[model samples]
Target: MSKVIEIQDSQFNDEVVKANETVLAYFWAPWCGPCRLVSPSVSWVAENYSDRLKVVKLEVDASPDSVATCKVEGVPALRIFKDGNMISSHEGAIGKQGLQDFVESAV
Candidate 1:
């Protein structure tokens, strides 16, 4: 599988909430500066933690339903889901170490 999968509202349930393994959904928007800053770290984590986690990107503007469902008021939201439920979430541009800590703490 790819390091990161671009997710849409229609696939959110089957791909994320019900995923067998832990999933990190990175919710972002095209115009958000913070989102851009956090994107690389998200991808890096995806590649490094391929076994422990799954990273999926969700564009807020295109996925309104998921954006609302996830309660994302801003871009660069990172939510971790396991066993069909959300375990943790962070809403801002976080660095590589911060992202690592975020995932490590949850898993």
Candidate 2:
């Protein structure tokens, strides 16, 4: 099983921005109800799509600077990055199928 990498502000640039592979970042806050609802699907995507995508989890509360830089206005936001640039983003909780589609479309 693949693990969702926990990202912090300090390493945001090195981990996500300059990542060698396509990255899917799940930006969430612990207090957000919707974020909790999307957790499992995020994990599933991490494990299932490990071959082609790099999955990471970022806590908005802990990584404030990174969140601000990403311009994330809400929790449960998913962003896809490739070649050091954000390629796509989705704001809201979604199911496994939706996550698969999100990643597939970006790739």
**Clashes per model (N, Cα, C within 3 A):** 0, 0
Where model 1 places Cα greater than 4 Å from the true spot, the runs are none
Clash pairs (backbone) in predicted model 2 = none
Q: Please identify model 2 stretches exceeding 4 Å from their true place.
A: none
Q: Please, what are the lDDT tens digits per residue for candidate 2 over residues 65-107?
A: 9889888999899999999999999998887788889989987
Q: Rate the local accuracy (lDDT) of all candidates.
A: 0.91, 0.90
Candidate 1 global lDDT? 0.91
Encode model 1's per-residue lDDT on 7-35: one tens digit a residue.
89999999998899999999998899998
- All candidates: TM-score: 0.96, 0.94
Q: Which candidate is the best by lDDT?
A: 1
